[model samples]
Target chain A: MELKDYNSCVQEWADPLFRFAYKCSGNEEDARDVVQNSFEVLWQKRQEVYADKAKAFLFQVAYRQSVDLFRKKGRIQYTEQPEFSGSSNPGNPDLKRVLERALSQLDEQSRALVLLKDYEGYHYDEIAQITNLSETQVKVYLHRARKTLKNYLVSVENIL
Target chain B: MVTLENYEEYIISYVDGALNAAELQELEAFIAHHPELRSEMSAYENTRLMPDTSMIYANKEALLKQAPKRTISLGNWRSYGVAAGIIALIGTAILLWQHTNNNHVATIVNVTINKNTAQAPVGPIAHENPIKKDKAIQQPVIAAVNHRKQARPGIASAPGINRLTVNDHQNNTAQPSQEKPEVNKPVEIARITALPEPKTIDTISPAKVLTAVITPNETMVADKQDEKDPFAWLPIDDTKKQGLKDLKKTVDKTVKEVRSVTNNLKETALVFKFGKKEITLNF
Candidate 1:
């Protein structure tokens, strides 16, 4: 990719990549670091990447740095804890906060898969490409993660 | 296909928008048959996270890149033209300087020749002592030439040496005839006859005289050859012609040096100034 195309990728994909990294790593600082590193890798390999595939390439880098690296470093740490606590309290009825808590509950890989699927709306194959997983694995993991989230939301709804 | 065993997969795919029209209809029909599962599917749909538009990456300007620097090459026609013009100008200047220096040297040579010719006595002078005749003839002419040369600093003294030698020879012959009246008449007559005719020296042009002074032996041979060949009207000395060729070679070498300097300049960075901004392009 040319410099202009790479810069355009930065402008277009930086926010989404940051959000994906943030959701996957559950830390704003780590998310920012992931975004910076992903763009840096993209710039270094700009010649090898095409402008059309730049977004996917960036997401792939972000996914590996945020999910794989964080997992390798041990269990995930949330610098900013989600507002919702897993409790039977009906006062906290915010569905978005409950969903955030639910998303934090999933493993890093599954969370990255879910973020890649829902936030970026990538297909199973594209998510597999980004996460370096088979299409079957992406589908199975995403379904499992969706069930976990649905169960959490159901329990919260029952309490409400 | 949307049975209870595989119902969760269909519900996830439905929420993910992965279900096509037929799969959607099948899942909806299955859900209609199981009204309790409708809320379950709705819970799965709520799991799809909407990206917070407010959670944008701040300072996007930091990720942007500037365009890479471009290299300038010497292939430009303007650069070639400038180099050619510089070489030509340098060559012209060298040639002009050489021409002017040659003319100046020739002028000095002619002035010395004219002065020597005018000062030397036409008639022979007799010397009292034969031993002193040789020294007297040599000393005065050399001293006079040296004194005249010293008067005009930086002029070449080589061209005047030959003219002074001829003048000393004339003086030596005159010494014997004037100082020794008792010497044999035949010997005195032969000595006078041996001397070159003054008319011959007066008749020869200054340019030929200068050529004769530079290469006396070669000039004499060429003169003898000219006596035989009818077409030998222009008698050119080989050494003088070689000197001119050497000067031409020097001018050519100077032009080559100028060309090399210009080529080196092409390898350096070209800087252009526009008001306060300066752009430098490297080759």
Candidate 2:
């Protein structure tokens, strides 16, 4: 895409990407960094990037940079096993906190895949492309991440 | 019968809409049998929907404020490098200029002394003395070196010095200072004796030997031969005596004159040519 087109695309995607990044990163500052850095990458590679796929590219870039920030700070681990437990009403405030904590507990790629799929309503193929995984892999990862959040919510309710 | 693992795989595919019609029906029938698995599915769906509650828009203004907006795309570090390069270039130019200036001054002084000394005619008194010649050579060398020092800048860098192949010449010329003891003693004497003595009024001018005296000094000392007061008015040379007689007869001019003498012979000549003009002496 040319600079003009990329700029208009940025205007369209900036808020949504920022909203997702802010949710993922848990802070306005880091969220903005992720979003701005993603736009910068898109701007730099504007010529090579297809205009139709610009939205996916921007979100992927932001998610990846946010993941890198999490890894570098050692706030997230890469190899924890997900736990699944059956529960009722996982969206309550206490269960929500438990689920958010469990969501944070998942690996960055799995967390991003789950968020993109379940929250953003992205297709499995779209998630796979954005996360550089196969469509099957995206489904598997999102399933595991969702199951872990569910188990943590149920277990936390049992404790309460 | 569909197993629990098969059911879970089928359910996962169902969530992704990847399962075909029969597989979706099987997943639905399996979940119907398993109430706990059905509740897990509902929990997963709720978990998936929940992150949006906390989702917030990133504050772009705060991010931009913290990250320092760039006015110029070139970095500060690179600008510093450019500034350093310019300073280095200026320093090199200054060094080169100083070096060339010094060499030019040295060359000029060397050539000037060489030409000037060669041009002057030696007087009879100095021509007879071998010591005078030795002294003359020594004195010129000191003057040449002093002039070279004043004219030659020591700090300047010279590229042409190598290409011109003047290394041996420079070494040889610089070598004389190493033998300065021998050169120094004679140089002092040559400088002192070769210099013309101060003149007295009693002595006539040496104008007859040369063109008009461009740097005439009445105080300049004439050649010192007179010691007694006999015929003190007599001109220093016979050529001057004839010239004065012819001048007095032709112009019939009587000129007031003052002459001081310690001997009969006047120690100075009456006429001399210096350059393009003839100058005659009256006293």
- Judging by lDDT against the true structure, name the best candidate: 1
RMSD of each: 15.6, 23.0
| Model 1 interface Cα RMSD in Å | 0.7
Clashes of each: 5, 24
The candidate 2 chain B region of ten consecutive residues with least summed lDDT is B211-220
TM-score of each: 0.55, 0.43
Model 1 chain A lowest lDDT segment of ten: A76-85
Model 2 segments more than 4 A misplaced: A2-4, A76-95, B16-22, B50-283
lDDT of 1 at B3: 96
What TM-score should be assigned to candidate 1? Answer: 0.55
* Top TM-score prediction, candidate number: 1
